[model samples]
Target: MLEQSTRSERGSMTGEEARRAVREGRLSCQTSSLAPGYVQGNLVVLPQDIAGDFLRFCQRNPKPCPIIGMTEPGDPHIPDLGVDLDLRTDLPGYRVWRDGELVEEPGDLLSHWRDDLVGFVIGCSFSFEEALLADGLEVRNVAEGVNVSMFRTSIPCAPAGPFAGPVVVTMRPFSPADAIRAIQITSRFPSVHGAPIHIGQPEQIGIRDLSKPDYGDPVAIRDGELPVFWACGVTPQAVIAAARPPFAITHAPGAMLVTDLKNSRLSIL
Candidate 1:
């Protein structure tokens, strides 16, 4: 386990060290602002039968669903994410959906593991958040200790089999200058949700109200800041829920899987 003796040590660990702690059940909580420069992922587990279709959906809709890494059916580890990574147990919390409705919320998904289950890791906002912070921009969600605000948008994702629905997005309010910097910084990391899909007007993306988010926490939007929207990994979960597959699993929002890969490694340039 990574010692939490001091904040510095906890903050200094390589991305893999942090994942090891999560896999051992030593840390099962929000990963926000942790593993400062490493990639953090949103996980989706599905039966082998439908995994191929889901992959196609992701391929067609890369913005909301970039595939960072995936595991073979029934396999728990994604060597690319971390040698110690176990899809069934590494994430802090999981949502078990049966026939498209959330039925159980578990800290880990060990018991639900099936012989035909496959795990897909979607790039998350956390990856880009690291990039923003590195450039000295304050990430409001981290500063406020809240999950990034997410919403079901008017944008429709490319349909693949049963995986088709309106796209969902996460919001972060920023000044014009900072928002531009965020775009530039995040653009360099396409694996972690590349860049903002929309900016300024929430209603422009079918988000009628900024104060009421469909998922996660609502942050204060002060004067002069625009709500920048990024295609969110949660879009898959929402689609799965509406499609109502017999069984599906997703990492609980904000409670993500920290991978061994550094956020810097995700940069395109």
Candidate 2:
């Protein structure tokens, strides 16, 4: 867990500053609280051969795979996201997968860059967190200095080519009133996974244990609070694994690419 005192400092950091810290090896932890108003994104890199299919997959399932930015074949920079955003190194951590299995968890992707790779930056729920906070609702993972809990659900995504898999969701416990407010607040930010897909009853979504999440860390669910679920950007990792792509790369759960785009810019209102 991170010190609560640094929360303010992290919130004050610019996207570039946070990315620089990750690149310089100064910060390599869950980025839920850093660059508070900036758009943080989940990273997915695939070979040019399969990139088209993956793009269609994202288009088919916009809720969990909303595309915020994308890179040309073999390119590392996304000019719209950040002037100096290097997809190869901006994120704090990365997962390397081969034949549908995780093979490495590296801090940087310097050695893995290839001419055939294409990068995709998927909109993350973190971008809407600021709105939630501004509305006076607590974002538990940020308060506890832990990654938000994520689970694989029985709900299936609309498949595109080989990218078929179950929907993945992030859980945040909230009072019934706050949950409704949260839904209203997040609905304006559709690019960052708009609203809750499930309000309560974890088993209805096939989540057997709230304490044991499929990805990320579980947080306390206090009395009178309902476990609200939102579509997660981590859905791609699960899709990639099921598709058995020969090679793929993704941001580690909770560690995302901090973009220059502000979270407010994503709101429709």
lDDT of 1 by residue, 1-269 (tens): 22343456557767777777777766656776567887888888999999999999999999999999999999988997888788877777899999988899997777899889999988887777877877899888878988889999999999999989999999999999999988888889788789889999788779999889999898998799988999998898888888788889998867888888877888989
RMSD of 1: 2.2
Clashes of each: 1, 0
> For candidate 2, lDDT tens digit of each residue in 175-262?
8999999999999999999988898999999999999998889899899999999999889878998899999999987788999999
Model 1 stretches with alpha carbons more than 4 Å out? 1-9
| Model 2 residue 150 CA deviation in Å | 1.7
Model 2 poorest ten-residue lDDT run: 1-10
